[model samples]
Target: MTYKLHKLLPAGAAVVAFATMMTNAAADQIVKIGHVGPLTGGSAHLGKDNENGARLAIEEINAKGLTINGQKVTLQLDAQDDAADPRTATQVAQKLVDDKVVAVVGHLNSGASIPASKIYSDAGIVQISPSSTNPAYTRQGFKTTYRVVATDAQQGPALADYAAKGLNVKSVAIVDDSTAYGQGLANEFEKTAKSLGLKVLSHDATNDKAVDFRAILTKIKGENPDAIMYGGMDATGGPFAKQAKQLGLRAKVLAGDGVCTESLAQLAGAAADNVVCSQAGMALEKMAGGAAFSAKYQKRFGHPIEFDAPFTYDAVYIVVDAMKRANSTDAAKILAQIPGTNYNGVIGTTAFDAKGDLQHGVISLYNYKAGKKTLLDVVKM
Candidate 1:
C-alpha cells in the first residue's frame, strides 16, 4: 500500500504541473483589428478587395504565432460594411470601438472615411485608410487618422499634368459625382488644368448612384472639349465612357483613382480603350512585391487584387509593426506608435507626415489596351 501511494502522488503532481503550464499559455491576448468598406453597394467589389487584403494579413500573422511583449498573440479581423454612406460609417465605427478593436484598416471612400474618422478619434483608436484620397481626411487635425494613398491635392495635379503633356489636351470638360471624393478631386484637377492653360469648358455634377449620364454627356458634347474628366468610381465612370462613345463624342475620358481598376475594361467594354485614369500609388506591375503578392492574393481570394488591396495589405502590416514596436497591444499604445512607422511594405516605404498622411506618396497614370490596364508612368510626389 505504501509503494502504490508514492507512485500515485508523483503522477498527480505531474498532471497538475502540465495543466498549470497550459493555463499560463492560454492567457495570451487576442487583438482585434477592424476593417470597414462598402460591402453591399455598387462599390462592393472594391470593398471586398480591401477586406481580402486585411484578412490575408491577419491569417499570415496568426499562422506565424505573433508575439508581443513576450505574450503569444493572435490577430482577429472584425470586418464591417459601411455601404459607402457617411452616416452608416459612423455607426459602424462606434460598433468597432465598442468591440475593442485595437486598430482599423478601412472606410475605402473619403465620403465615408471623413465621418468615421471622428468616431475613431473619440475612441482613441487608430484608422489607416487604404484608398480614401480626400485631403480633408487627414487634414482635420485628428492624429488617429492616416491613409496609405496620396490625397486629391497630389493625384489631381498629376492627372492634369498627364493630360496636358502626355495627352496634349487643349480644352477639358469636368464632371463629378458630387460626393466628397468626386468633387474634391475634380476641383483639384480643374485648378491644375486651368493653371496649365487647358481651357475649362464646363463643370457638371452627377449623383454617385446615377445610371444615365446622357443629359450630362449631351451638355459636355456641346462643349466639344478635347477631354472629359469624370470624378467617380468605375461603376459610373465605365458607363459614362461607354455612353460618350455611343453619343459619338470624339473626346477621350479622363478620371482619377476611383475609376482605375482591373474591372474597368469589363465595365466599360470597348470604350475602356479610350479611357485614361490615374491611381494614387505605383502600378501593381511596378510594385517591388507585386508579383508575389498578386499570386498569393489570387490563390487565397479566388480573384485578382483590385484598386487598393495592396495598400490595405500594407496597412495591416503597418499596424502589426506598430504593435511590435510599442511592445503592447493596448489601443492607446498602438495609436502612439503609428506616427513613428517606417516599415518597408509591398506598396513602398510607408511613413506618415505630421498630418498622418503618407509622406512619400506616388501617383501612377494608366491607359487600357486590349482590355487591360497598362501603366504609363509613376510620378513621385
Candidate 2:
C-alpha cells in the first residue's frame, strides 16, 4: 500500500506540472492592430490589397511568435472598412480607439486619413497610412500620424515634370474630383505646371461620384490642350481616359498616383495606352523585395496587387519593429519609438521626417502598352 501511494504521488505531481504549463500557454497576451480602408466602395480593391498586406504580415509575425516585455504575445488584425468616405473614416477611427487597438495601419485615402488622424491623436495611438498622399495629412502637427508613401507635393511635381520635359507638352487642362485627395493633387500639379512655363488652359472640378465626364470633356476639347491632367482615382480616371479617347481627344492623359494601378488597364481598356501616371512609390517590380512579395501575395490572395500593398506590408512590420525596440506592447511606448525608426523592409528603407512623411520618397512613372502597365522612369525626391 505504501509503494502504491508513492507511485500515485509522482503521477499527480506530473499532472500538476502539465497543468501549470497549459495555464502559462493560455495566458499569452493578445495585441490587436487596427487596419482601416475602403472595403466596399470604388477603391475596395485597393483597400483589400492594403488589408491583405497587413494581414500577411500579422500572420507571419504570429507564426514566428512575438515576445514583448517578457510576455508571449499573439497579434490580431482588427480590419475596418471606411468605404473611402471622410465621415465614415472618423467613425471607424473612434471605433478602433474604443476597441483598444495598440496601433493602426491605415486609412488608405488622404481624405479619410486627414480627419481620422485627429481621432488617433486624441487617443494617443499611432496611425500609419500606407497610401494616403495629401500633404495636409502629415502637416496637421500630429505626432501620431505617419505615412509610408510620398505626398501629393512630390508626386504632383514628378508628373508635371514628366509632362513638361518627357512629353514636351506646351498647354495642359486640369480636372479634379473635388475630394481632398483629388483637389489637393490637382492644385499641386497646377502650381508646378505653371512654374515649368506650361500654359494652363483650364482647371475644372467634378465630384468623385460623377460618372459621366462628357460634359467636362467637351468643354476641355474646345481648348485643344496638349495634355489633360486628371486628379482622381482609377474608378473615375479610367472612364475619363476612355471618354476622351472616344471623343477623339488626342491629348495625352496625365494622372497622379490615385489613378496609377494594376486594374487601370482593365478599367480604361485600349484607352489605357493614352494615359501616363505617377505612383508615389517605387514600382512593385523595382522594389527591393518586390518579386518575392508579388509571388507570395499572388499565392496568398490569388490576384495581382492593385497598388499600395507593399507599403501596407512594410507599415505593419515597422509597427512590430517599434514594439521590439521599445521592448513593450504598450501603445504609448510603441508610439515613442516610432519617431526614431529606420526600418529596412519589403519597401526598402523607411524613415520619417519631422512631419512623419517618408524621408526619401520615390515616384514611379508608368504608361500602359498592349494592355499592360509599363514603367517609364523612376524619380527620387
Candidate 3:
C-alpha cells in the first residue's frame, strides 16, 4: 500500500522527519509523542492518516506556545509504520520504546493495536487509538490502552440490529477479512443477529488483497438471505460490495466502521449506493472543528488522508491536555490523567468511560446514495 504523506515535509519523509524530531527534541523542552500505524502494506492509508494527524496537531501546539507547568513546550511525534501486521506492530512499539516518548497515539487496525498494546502497557506508556473498534482490546484489562472509537461490540451489533430489526430483514449472511477487526466484528454481529432471532445462514473470510468475492457472494446468495454483512475496512469491503453487486446479489450489504470511509463510495461506485455502513465518531467534515481541521489537513497533505483524520488530530491534543494537567511527562501521570478528559475534540466532546473507552456514544449510520454517503441517523452510544 502507498502512503499519502502530509505536505508539512517533502514526500517520502514521514518516518525520517518524525523520528528525527523525536530524537532531537531531547535538547529542547518537548512533550514527545509517538504515533504507530500502518505506513505501508495494505492498510497504508489509515496509517498515513494517523501519522499526519498527530504531526499536524503537534506542530500547531508547538507553534502556539502550548505549555506545561507555566513553561512553553514544543511537541513532537515519533511516527512509525507497523505495516498492519502483528509482528511489524510490535516492532513499531519497540521503536517508540527506544525513543522513550511521553505518550502514544496509534496502530490504526485493531489487530495491530491489540498486541502492540501490551508493549505500551507493560512499559507504563499511555496509548490512545483514534480508530480501533475491537471490544477485546479494551476488555483485556490494560489500563493504558484507550480508543476514541466505539468498540466492535457497539458498532457491529448495532449494525446487525438495524439490519434485523430496523431494516426488517429476516436473514443475513456475513463475511470477514480474517483480520482482528473484521473477524471480531463479524462474530459480534453473528451473535447479536442470532439473539434477535435473525437467521445467520452463511459466514466466510477473505483478506485485504482479495479482488474477487464473487464466490463468496455466490455462496451467500444460495442462502437467500435478505442482506449480506461484511466485517472489514474499505480496502477490502469496498471491492466486496462492488463484486457482490456484479455477481447479481441484490441483497443489501451492511458493514461496520471498518468499511465506513468516503473512499468506499469511490471503490464501490454505483454499487455503493444504498449500501449501509456504520462507524463511531462524527465524520471529519461533520464534527465540530471539522472544516478547520480538514482545511489544515488538505493544506498539509495536498489531499485528505482519511475520513477520521480529525479524530487523530484530537487524540494528540487530548494527550497534550493530559500532559498539561498532570504537570509532568511521566507516563503514569499521563495515563491517570486520561480518564477525566472532557477535551473539546474535533470529533466532539470526548471523555473516557471507566474502561478507557472514549464516551463516544456517537455512532452514525450511513448509506451511499448517488456517489455520496447520506447520514441516516446518529445513535448515541
What TM-score fits each model? 0.94, 0.94, 0.89
Give the 10-residue window scoring lowest on summed lDDT in candidate 1: 22-31
Q: Return the TM-score for candidate 3, rounded to 2 decimals.
A: 0.89
lDDT by residue for model 3 (61-94), tens: 8778775665657777888888889898898898
Model 2 regions lying over 4 Å from their true place: 1-26
lDDT of 2 by residue, 44-68 (tens): 9999999999999999999999998
The true-versus-predicted C-alpha distance at residue 175 of model 1, in Å, is 0.4
Provide the RMSD of all predictions against the true structure, rounded to 1 decimal. Answer: 3.2, 3.5, 10.8
Task: Show the colliding residue pairs in model 2.
Answer: none
lDDT of model number 2: 0.94
**In terms of TM-score, how similar is model 1 to the real structure?**
0.94
Query: What is the alpha-carbon lDDT for the whole of candidate 3?
Result: 0.83
Score each candidate by Cα lDDT.
0.94, 0.94, 0.83
